[model samples]
Every structure is written in structure tokens, then in C-alpha cells.
Target: MLTINVAFLLAVIVLVRLRRRTEARSRSDERFTVVIVLALGVLIAPTPVGEGIFDLLGQLASGITGASR
Candidate 1:
């Protein structure tokens, strides 16, 4: 569990640094970044419009884990 947590933390840090570098080169009117963040936020969080997405992901994950046996 400790190793898994450390790995997850490292992964998050690396991803954040990479994303920051990527965003640093973009202009203020970055519609692509805005849209991508909005879509990702909506997908990961619960809202009326996001409920279906969350449900689908949950079902998919469940199916994948269930099939691993």
C-alpha cells in the first residue's frame, strides 16, 4: 500500500509538471485547454450532465475488475 501510494504520488507530480510546462507555452485565449479541463472536470465530478458519464465509467470499471478473474 505504501509503495502504491508513493507510485501514485510520483505519477501525479510528473503529470502536473508536464501539464504546467505544456500550458506555459499557450496564450491567454486558450480555448483548447479550457474545453479540455471543463470536459475532464465534468467527467470526473458529479453534476446533472456528468451523472451519465460517471455511471458509465463506474460500470466499465466494475466490468473490467469482474472479468479479471
Candidate 2:
């Protein structure tokens, strides 16, 4: 049996989209790419990696707020 990590697949898609030439993409293409990336994020958000990301973002946000005060 072969198992695949969906997050990894999504990351690949996101990277490919990012690497594409900006001028070649239309508005709808941009929107579709955003949707795909958002879907990837939702898929990732329930895993351990997602938890770490949330924690890191939280700390970063607090640090920014603390620095600005």
C-alpha cells in the first residue's frame, strides 16, 4: 500500500503556482490558484505541522505587538 501526505502535494501545487510567470495568468487563474492554496491550508490545519504553524504565528503576532508598544 502506498500512502501520500496531502499537505506535501498541496505544497507542490502552491510552489508551482508561485513559480509560474505572472503575466501568463488571468484574473480567474489567479483566483483558482488562491482557492487551491486555501484548500491546501485547510487540509494541513488539522495535523501536527499545522499546530506548530499556528503556535509560531501566534508567537510572532505577539512579538510584533509587544515590539510596537
- The candidate maximizing lDDT is 2
lDDT per prediction? 0.60, 0.93
Error of 2 at 6 (Å): 1.8
Q: Candidate 1, residues 1-69: lDDT per residue as tens digits?
A: 334443345445545644665546556535655655555564446656568777888999999999998
Provide the lDDT at 24 for model 2. 94
lDDT of 1: 0.60
lDDT per residue as tens, model 2, 1-69: 999887798899899998999999999999999998999989989999999999999999999999999
Q: Whose TM-score is greatest here?
A: 2
lDDT of 2 at 16: 91
Worst 10 residues of 2 by lDDT: 4-13
TM-score, structure 2 vs. true: 0.91
